[model samples]
Target: MEFLAIILAAGKGSRLKSNLSKPLHEVAGYPLITWVSKAAHAAGASTQICVISPDEQQLYRELSHTMKTVIQVAPKGTGDAVRCCLPHIEKLPKDCPILILYADTPLIQADTLRDLANRIEAGTDICLVGFTADDPTG
Candidate 1:
């Protein structure tokens, strides 16, 4: 099924206490955003848009070859980050499925995303993927 993957990656990573953006941080061999994009692509997303901050020039340059990007302008919230991609989203088909993902979550699997898309195709209005963590404390 054809779907749009909107990756929200505008966080300043203040919590990580690092100069590097959260998405640019490497989990294994690839950047976090790279892993997310790979899963999105494998799940059959026809279009992918990455939501980034204004100062993320390096992120923009890196993702330029594969996907489109929109600047969130301010670190308002997740809603505002997705809102920045409205122009690009509007151009897609009205009924097209949209999958919202976080770039920092590199552990998500492509099969999981495909299953979510399958649920949507099976007439589910909206699908949210989540897991119960044994230890919620960070």
Candidate 2:
């Protein structure tokens, strides 16, 4: 199933207290966003778009070979980040499914994404993946 993967990588990750962007941080030798993009691709996402903050020129250069990107001019919230991709989204087919992903959550598996897409194909309008956390604290 062909779908568009919108990887939100614009967060400043202030809590991490690092000089690098959150998504640029390495996880098991690969950048966090790279893992997310790989899972999206393996899940049959024909197109992927990464939403990044204005100062992420290095991130842009790294991702240029894999997918398109849109910049969030301001450090707005998630909604604004997604809005930056509106023009590109408009060009896709109306029935095309869109999968929203977080770059920091690299543990997500491609099989899970494929299952969600399968649900969408089976006529579900939306499929969300979430888990109940015991503490729900950072």
Candidate 3:
């Protein structure tokens, strides 16, 4: 089955304290978006789609020439960003799998993604990636 990826980068990231799109921010000497996209690519994604805010069009365009992008006129919730890629998803090969991810988590490893894809291929419907808490809150 073909694999497709959608990277959600439309959030306002109010806590970031700058006008730049959060995905454009550098993490370990590379833009957060780059790492996210590369992970998806390494995960066997045939195409990567990124949803960007209207103001971030130029930034998004300069990143990956082969990437598919959708403009989110308003900063909405994650679900809304997924909706923007619906049309593109619909045209994908039937039974094709689409992986959705955020642009902020640059530490995700390729093996992790491959494991997730393997599970999906083994008939799992949905999987959520998470981290274990080091300590319990009081």
**Backbone clash count for every predicted candidate, in the order shown:** 0, 0, 0
lDDT of 2 at 54: 82
- Model 3 stretches astray by more than 4 angstroms: 133-138
Please, what is the whole-model Cα lDDT of each candidate in the order they appear?
0.89, 0.90, 0.81
- Candidate with better lDDT, 1 vs 3: 1
- TM-score of candidate 2 against the unseen true structure: 0.92
Q: For candidate 3, which ten residues in a row score worst on lDDT? A: 57-66
> Which ten residues in a row are the worst by lDDT in model 1?
129-138
Q: Kindly list the per-residue Cα lDDT of model 2 for residues 1-138, writing each as its tens digit.
A: 988999999887899998788898999999999999999999999999999888888888888888999999998788898889999999999888888999988889999999888888778998989988789896
TM-score of candidate 3 versus the correct structure, residues matched by position: 0.86
User: Where does model 2 exceed 4 Å of error?
Assistant: none
Best by lDDT: 2
Write down the TM-score of every candidate: 0.92, 0.92, 0.86
